[model samples]
Target chain A: MMSDNSDIDKYYDVVVVGAGPAGIGVGILLQKLGINHIILEKTSIGESFRKWPIETRFISPSFTGNFFKMPDLNAITPDTSPAFTLLTEHPTGEDYVEYLENLAKYYDLPIKTEVCVDTVQKKADSFVLTTNKGEYKSTYVIWAAGEYQYPKTNAFEGTHLCTHYSEVDSFSDLEGDEHIVIGAYESGFDAMVSLIRARKVVTLLDDGDYLNLVKSDSSYSLAPFTRDRIEYVADLFDYYTETKVTSVEFVNDTYLVKTANGQTFTSPQKPINCTGFASSLTLVKESFEFKNDYPLLNDFDESTKTSNLFLVGPQVKHKNALFCFIYKYRQRFAIVAEKIAKRMKVPSQAIEKAIQGYKDNNFYLTDLSCCDDECTC
Target chain B: MMSDNSDIDKYYDVVVVGAGPAGIGVGILLQKLGINHIILEKTSIGESFRKWPIETRFISPSFTGNFFKMPDLNAITPDTSPAFTLLTEHPTGEDYVEYLENLAKYYDLPIKTEVCVDTVQKKADSFVLTTNKGEYKSTYVIWAAGEYQYPKTNAFEGTHLCTHYSEVDSFSDLEGDEHIVIGAYESGFDAMVSLIRARKVVTLLDDGDYLNLVKSDSSYSLAPFTRDRIEYVADLFDYYTETKVTSVEFVNDTYLVKTANGQTFTSPQKPINCTGFASSLTLVKESFEFKNDYPLLNDFDESTKTSNLFLVGPQVKHKNALFCFIYKYRQRFAIVAEKIAKRMKVPSQAIEKAIQGYKDNNFYLTDLSCCDDECTC
Candidate 1:
């Protein structure tokens, strides 16, 4: 480890790294209590959501997406639509990005959008953060940098033929003669559908059978107009049409995927990879001592390694269950935000109010403006 | 009111009415335990669903629709798609009906469809259900007959100008005319959209300004495809778009509508209405004393007005919240079915297994065949 030039002169009430769900969530709680805090992000806010495929909508409804301490959407506006209506209409990735942006603007959260923290070393009573911009010294530090930042590629024979899930954002980008998407996760299935829609000959490889873990009230298959053009060769041939791609090799400038059944499928459409993302915690590894490579958090919110340092979002899932997707992110964010605010000695009412508004079970949809025929705006 | 028919002798394990969500849910549960029961429906199974307009789909997703005491969907078949996938694919009224049918067949529940009960009279120890088919006796009656059966037409002058939601199943039946949909409830909005899509001038009426609910995850406005065809003129523009029909008096050659707003609008198309629906429980009022003209039940499973009689489906919503809808019915049915099965002393490991599965939060999607690729049976 390099010698640390840690700054102990300035101390913040709290320092949160990564302006994604967890960081912003804590920032929201602190702002609600009128507490001074700083949020450092390596990129723009909700960069992961921004990178999501255009057609990718939230798997769960908006009822689970509210931030704590805000007014219940229904209480705010009970006329236009209800929680159920809004939830049924799946919000796309762009919609979420817009929602997060609006939320950040609404709270006027204290955030440093482009600051990348390089190290986080704990002093006697505080954490010292060394960033590309400068040093951020705080009494409490929350390492909320999410887990999807790192792209994990296995040492396969043709590893270069695949791309990360983050790279493929739209169907139009999937243009080639034939393509093979690796991984059997939701991302892989999503990519398969997208590639098929783009009219690309596609082969999906998986070590395990892909499962579609969706829930509904009834069995209705609602296909969008965009999806109407795509056709699955095996419609309703069980949940997922099972197939196996064993290996990928180049044949006549085209990638040929060999299946375990001795079937060779050729695809020229630049083989896009849909494998899931991994945690990018290497940057602060030297500074922060992790328990079994984890932030040492207890339950969902408490960070054991550092007193003030907390972890939320997909990063926390690294230590426990992989529950960092959009549906689970907001709910978990609210929990961590409340815990962090309480630990910082913020007023209980403010945090409580935020939690009340943001907690699960209750959902609302509110229109910002009261529109009358006389006044269009 | 006629004299009480307490002298009748009718005994059954349970008599469930209205073959909608609640009725079918309970029926499936009873079937799992080999309980001898009869599910009574005045119309077809899921009759209200069948009556729904072609464009209507469930607001809730499918994952929440499973009845208790059933195998987790994953345990049954991994090929089964989650409720959301099916619902999002082609959301239509018939799609849900088909799912219900599949579930009913899978369980082979004892259900007598199209047996409308005219009255239910409590006897000394059981209940007698006088239906169009025949008089049946039961120890318990669950009222699952849902709301939307009785049309609650507003007592407005020239009421003939409006139509109930149930009758307006298709826009093709609507003739040429500038139409005004009366309420802003779900049905009212649905009608307005349908009329507007049919290229008719449409106006929505609300006592208060319509509340702006939360936006859908996909878009901020109404469902994208549905919103595109319809034009929503808010009440503020009432002066500009008020082609009101004061009196729907018809002449020999054509029908004329006199507008109260000093504008007479006449179209070759008859004005359509979408006020709302009342519960179909009115038929049993003479037979049983009701509180608030609604049966006071132990939370929604109208399994007994007396004994051996159950009212399931939309009618239950009349007495309570409209929970007989797909998402909540299965849960309610599980309770009633378990009680009845226990009363009948049916030997059932399936019910016990299902309860455990539910307690574990293991959803139906997880109930799949263990066989991956080789297990064909």
Candidate 2:
């Protein structure tokens, strides 16, 4: 439900920024709790998902096993499955956006689109969010502006000479016969595969041997979907491990890519940078204390420095656990909503009933100890 | 560990037949409960998995989210993941065998391969299983022999003229370029896709419109993985829905497949029948009362007519819930084990502690009500 700037309330018990999976997820919880809340999206629901490269598919496969208490990995809520809705295992960016939009409509979540929150400031008792449309105040603020839109473009010297992976509308539309892809992670391999499939030769430079490094956690390792895609095209690409790209130099319509290993490669077109994304937390850096570039979060995911100000989405980190993926970060949605609702003096029984489904499924993860264990087999 | 036939005990509390996922899964639970039991297999471990067609991959995808309480869908045990062990999402039959072998070795399960149970006769208080090696007696008999190896060859008239879907070693190795595949379920679609990819012309005769039928339960519908595989090859072949094959006839070195709709398709080679399989429960049909060809069982999946006789694996059905997939039936492992362990008077705490991980990780599903809800979006 899109509300006009004038129609939106000036104040709410909770205000969620961004209409991505994290924002929509937590907003559903708050709505269920009967808490006054609004989700403000800079663009529209699932804007980041809609902006994904055309060839890019979700590395994590989706399956409808929600009835067995195992929700689809890509589902925002336990009751919905992307696979069932989209009828595809690896939903495209557009397909996922449809899922998010469906959720927003089904839940009748109060959302205001095209309202960009430029800055957030804490007053004596409330958070004042200054948006492009107008000012809004909330007792609790959930910063769910995800990381995908904020690409890490300034990673190396002369990085602007290259195209970031996120900016590509489609790999097949690239004007070059050959391309040099920097950073050999999920996005890197994805770009390389798409290029190769488009009948182009590609070179991949990796800072680490991600292909050989297998971790028990899907969060740390290359997903099986990526591995499967790369397996068929492994012989078609030039892959250099431990060769971190230093910079790209454009000379005479040629791009010379230099690496940390003192090796240089030439490409006719601008090299593609797949060095990953910067956290959206950069926007609200002053609200939370920093530890190793991650915002400090308490047990309830509230900011350590600012009271009632919370962090959701991929930026949420507790110890070694990186809540980056939808499955990982989604677990914290209820915890954030519950804390805000409880503090608002919502009835205890109502809160319990509202969050019971999340608790029953793996959505509400409070115990961080289980996140670090390696698979025995 | 493989036990010698000479060292096998003549008497036990439980004797689990077949060393596939069902038997092995239940055996682990029984061992954890400190119950005296032995799992007997006619062949080596994962014999059914080993027998799958060379090009066939698991319809259900596997991901290692075990730490977050979501175990791999194909994993028999809660702690183990096929994706982690095999490092693939849709593991081939051979790859899956490796995972099953690893689980068997890791748990040090009491497995006696090459010992086929010929006859299971109830002898007053105990059930006597007469095997190829010798006679063994047990208070409880868990018939976990899966249905894959048991192909339904007599589904139609003159079906012997055609090759059953289970009999094909590889679709690429088939004798002719043109083939007729009967029954358009998972196996039928798999055969068609593999043959088409191998540069063959194929015609499919489906008994029902499975492609158009969408069910909330994965067991009742084609999996997303199957849908993805067929998406690329959908236009390459002729798919005849609501066309049931009635008979196959051999005439002048050519085979003719007759359908119920008065359609006759000709092929140089024998037609492929993928009508599906009869339950392995056929072996001990007299022990259990039958309803709609499914063995009638109580809440514990025990044969209603017989005492101390239980059922496990894909053959298990409760109302509309068809527990045919590994993820579906594995939930009953703990329930069956707990009941048998309790009857043997094992300590409640030990059983509880042993099955705690299963309960927490969705390995134990006692509530069947959740199995029927449809996805909202």
Candidate 3:
């Protein structure tokens, strides 16, 4: 029943890193399971969502579908919906932060904010987490630090010369008449729409024709929200599809955006990189194996190399099913919690009840193969 | 696999009236269940959706939540997502109509457009549907003719003097300097937002403080989307809470709106009524027994008074659960299909397979009690 870190023992049963949806989801379950765990947050809960561009909103819409076994698309837990809490469908960053804060308060989850985890080292039977606040010891560690903080700096050369889309507070604040935006994903299109709305001329460079692609998975396709926004501002921007940006260079107060097609564009503003994000697993790179720059996890989301160590959040991938969306990854919260609980020998009846609840609510998914089918209708 | 009514049999297992989500959904199941049935549309598939105000969008957010048993909120079927098909989170009426058209084509569900049902009478266990196009004989009938076409005109006196919100094709087209909007629900808020955006001075009268009311059920409260829109335009409108308009009188040029609170408001533009819609069930009132204005139905959604006649769509309420949203009413599609398929004596194996498919996807809800609980989080 306790969520606040009070009257605590020196050692904890588990320590979940990051207080975003993934960590909060795991922390909520662990608390419900009567497992003593402390959530270590580097900044605050939903900090990633808070850092989203000023005009940024969740492409996934939120509805109070909880009673119908469909947890709100953006909700981390089963009983909550950001739409109901924030009164918004596509919640802005601040709105989402409010939802996360409310969830944390409701569950009384033990989250220690402004406590940065510097490193994790396995010592004997327990893992030691050295944070800026203090050292923490736990039997199991759930790494849910997420990928927003770690932009893909190494994805392209001279990435530092350009501003990452995440760095821009608001497109309206950009001090330029003409801007050259590199990348055509959601963020890229978002930047385009906002800039156009603010009356700024933009040259949007796309690596691929992402606008026309309609893949079964939303991860591969531009979200419907983004598509609708693009449609509203498409005529206002100079779009170059099937063109990839290789690098950017500053020359005489202008960014020279070079592309894979051997073309270059000059912009008064630094070229924005909407390329994507790098896995925060670099924090514990040597501990687990990586494939395609992502952590390799077993069916239970447990690290392939590190036993009792679990991974959650947007970076999670099994073959092709990107557990990036809340609805997709929320399923694993129960599975991972069950695995950790079983390892700790938590009561069988409690485990069954909790897991069954998750299963009955459609919040538990064990199979990944079924996630590949396209909509027949 | 055929959709057009050209090759239809002289007698059908069931005849579904309306080609919107409800009827199209049931028709898809009937086609899959191997039952000979056809969907009759007064105009075309999703015509009501197409007829919605140009500024209107679905309050529900659409996500491809099918794998987790939560299909897109606006999807007619389990596998489809309006967000994925139309590429928009809150699709406009036109966008939704396109989605319905695509689904009908994909499923090849027999749908005859412009075939308006003038009268439906049951005779000796067979329902004879007399439409403008022709007469059809069916063993069972499903009335999916939604409520959009039947706006509640009798709720207030002098309603015809005021423009029902549904009558306005687009708020931008309204030629007005000042306007008085009646009702403060989703449509009222929507009209206010659109008119405000178009630079009109609006006076929105609310019978209650509906803006502050946050009910767990979306039916009672203003939609999250509407809330977000109101947040952006709240300052633009002159809001009058606890004001119920008893009547509207056009005195010469201006509209003098009379309220129960004894406050009168003058607007150059006619007041827009957002009081809500009347159930289309009154068209066949002699058949189904009514409870609190809604049709009383069995678990199967078949009429309590009329045998072999089914009811689907927003009007099909069971206790407190208003099956108004596609997600709610869609559950009964399989149940009704199974019941009719059983009576038609389609093999038990076929019925079981189809019904089990619905159950597995979380689309079949026989129990309404589970939907009453609010999210504790």
Give the whole-model CA lDDT for all candidates, comma-separated: 0.52, 0.90, 0.84
Tens-place lDDT per residue, model 1, B278-373, is: 557777655444666455455324433444445544344332233333332333455566666666665566667544433322222121121111
What is the lDDT for B77 in model 1?
19
Q: Which ten residues in a row have the lowest lDDT in candidate 2 chain A?
A: A2-11
Question: What tens digits encode model 3's per-residue C-alpha lDDT throughout A1-377?
Answer: 23344523459889999999999988889988999898888888999989988888888878887676666788777777888888888888988888888888888998888878889988888999987766889899999999988887865678998888888888899887888887888888888888899999999999888899987687788877788788888688999998888878888988888888899899878888888777888888877999987789999998899888899888889998888888788889999999999999999999987677678777788878877888875
Docking band of candidate 1: incorrect
DockQ for candidate 2: 0.80
Docking class of 3: medium
lDDT of 3 at A85: 83
A272-373: candidate 2 lDDT, tens digit per residue:
999999988887899999999899999999999999998888888888888888888889999988898888889999999999999988889998888788
RMSD of each: 11.5, 1.5, 2.6
In candidate 1, residue B305 scores what lDDT?
43
What DockQ, between 0 and 1, does each candidate earn? Answer: 0.08, 0.80, 0.59
Candidate 1 residue lDDT tens string, A1-377 = 01233322356877878776566655776676676677777888878767888867554333311111111121111111223233333456665555556556767776676677777888888778887777888877767787766776652446566566777767656555456676656566666666666666666666554343222211111222213222343351112235555566777877775666676666665555555565667765654357665555565455554566566665553323333443334445556666667776777887777666444222211111211111000
Between the candidate structures 2 and 3, which one is better when assessed by TM-score? 2
Q: After superposition, how far is residue B350 of candidate 1 from its true place, in Å?
A: 16
lDDT of 1: 0.52
